[model samples]
Target: MRRYGQAVLMLLVGAAVLRISLFSALYLRYVQSGLRPYLIASGALLVLLGVAAGVRAAREVPDEDETQDPHEHGHTHTTGPRLAWLLALPAAALLLFPPPALGSYSADREDAQRAAQGIGTFPPLPSGDPVDLSVAAFTSRAVYDSDRSLKGRTVRLTGFVTHGDDGTWYITRLLVSCCAADATTSKVEVRGADAPATDTWVTATGIWHPKGRLGSSAAWPPLLDAKAVRRVEEPSNPYEQR
Candidate 1:
């Protein structure tokens, strides 16, 4: 049972990995697209192993009844490891119910305590009304740019809302390198009106207030004086790629 089950579990795992990697959006929630090739390769290998195991099981002769007849013309068949079936749980879960990406809850937990990097000059912005910017990019400009680069522009930032104990609301977005495990969040204080429910996806159009102390790695983030807040559905890809 154990050995045969191992092969079957491997096959299922491989198929699930390939299915999510190739045909579904599930993998995008956990890791970047760069992992697709590796996932496909792993799935193929597992399937091959399972096929080999099945072939071996089929070719074996039947076992004799030990108690009834030792001299009887019969053979014994080997069963795979009995406990190897446990390995199927993860694969089954992933196949049936792939989880969503980290969101407001995850963002709320990760403080901006990451070691500072690339904290120098920022380039001028191209002309536009309500200039579009990612949450992370806006945070970087607000915190590190000494020139107040976001002074006049009405920037549009989209993220889920997170409520702070101090009665403030934040436009929060998680930045992930390759997966959620290493994700960090960039948050901006939302001012000008009452904040919506926590974890609500919103597009906050606002002007930068320069409220937080800038040019230093202070825990406080820059504030956005929100002129308009529109509730929106969560985006297909939740994490901001860093």
Candidate 2:
């Protein structure tokens, strides 16, 4: 088994990647959806490499009558470090019990790093009473849009619930530029509606409650006067693509 450690490690890693990107949508929790094809290809390559390595190792066996060490003939045999097999533990975990997507804990770790986009006029929204918008879009318009496109219009936003230290609760979603490692938080302060459990997915319909000057600190985390809140299943792709 030790002789085939490298092959086993490769197979474990390949299977883990395939389990998330090819067999399920779990890859969305870590990477952008558009990268799925690359992941699948890489996984397939790894599996093939593992199989090839196993075959080569099997064929390198010495004859029973030839007990000379290969090193005595100016040849040194090399294999992966024994400790390297520990790396397979994480791969096995990923294959068996993929972790959930980033939620409130990840959201809380981010502050107002996204406020640098100065205030500007945004395009008019489509004609409708209640417009469905992504959490990132709503946050952008509410915080920086000079036109106040969301004012007086009932808008719907979906995200998990996150609580502030001061009893404030927000409907929050993470925005990823490439993958979860670069994820940023977007949220709206919910008013007039009780906050559900933390990490609970919900769709909230409300009117924009302008708090302060556009692009100011006070305008951050723009408030929404929610009229209705409904529990919903978590989305397959939890992070919003920026």
Which candidate leads the pack in lDDT? 2
- TM-scores of the candidates are 0.84, 0.91
State the displacement of the C-alpha of residue 113, model 2, in Å, after optimal TM-score superposition: 3.6
**Candidate 2: where are CA atoms >4 Å away?**
62-80
Candidate 2 lDDT, 2-103, residue by residue in tens: 668889889999999999999999999999989999999999999999999899878877553246676677875454465688899999999999999999
lDDT of each: 0.80, 0.90
Per-residue lDDT of 1-242 in model 1, one digit per residue for the tens?
33366567877898888778877766778887788788778888888988888778667664434244544546543333434566788888888887777877787777666336545668987788799899988988887777778998999999999988899999998888988788888999999978999888999999988754565556257789999999999887777898
Could you list the CA RMSD of all candidates, in the order they appear?
4.2, 3.7
Against the hidden true structure, what lDDT does model 2 obtain? Answer: 0.90
For model 2, how many clashes?
0
Worst 10 residues of 2 by lDDT: 62-71
